[model samples]
Target: VARLQERARLFLELATQRGLDTGLSRGSAVIPVIIGDSALSLRLADRLFEQGINVHAISYPAVEEHKARLRFFITTLHSPDQIRFTVDALATTLSELRQEALYITPTN
Candidate 1:
């Protein structure tokens, strides 16, 4: 649960920085950033469907279940530039969604 708590903290900080605006869409309202085989599970799908959360569910042929994810959460101490970079990285990495191949694959 420690990991989940830390991740939640990171996401809240990020969303706040993004100008949470009205406190809606800040915390658990849009989280858990589903990962692994858990993403394919019925429970998770139901939770997402029922909650209507804006989950960014990543799927296979892209990443295995263990890696397939809507990756969110970053350290609070990371600089704005660092956070921007991370966001940019995600945008580029997932650009296929936009029909723009910003990156063929993520680098190590």
Candidate 2:
């Protein structure tokens, strides 16, 4: 649990420094990164799952109404490399999704 907390703190620091809108509390091992867009959150979660990484997303009624987020569970079994992988994957996935959204959204 101590190791998990350390890894989580490092991950959260890296993520926040990179400007990701993460909402997870530093005190908890479970990390919640705000996706803002529910669909994108689900899509990212699916992508991670397909890669053999079990992740979850919160949307709408599951959280506060109309809010969406991706939740990451940091367990004692997770190594530093694994945590780094998850964080990197999340950053990459989010960047790709944002780009796709920008392209798909109709311009005024």
Best by lDDT: 2
Which stretches in model 1 have alpha-carbon errors above 4 Å? 1-25, 28-68, 97-108
Decoy 1 TM-score against native = 0.31
Per-candidate TM-score against the hidden true structure: 0.31, 0.85
Off by over 4 Å in 2: 105-108
What tens digits encode model 1's per-residue C-alpha lDDT throughout 13-84? 654454322133344423433335433433344444444322355567565666545534344454455545
Error of 2 at 40 (Å): 1.1
Q: For candidate 1, what is the total of clashing residue pairs?
A: 0
User: Each prediction's Cα lDDT score?
Assistant: 0.44, 0.80
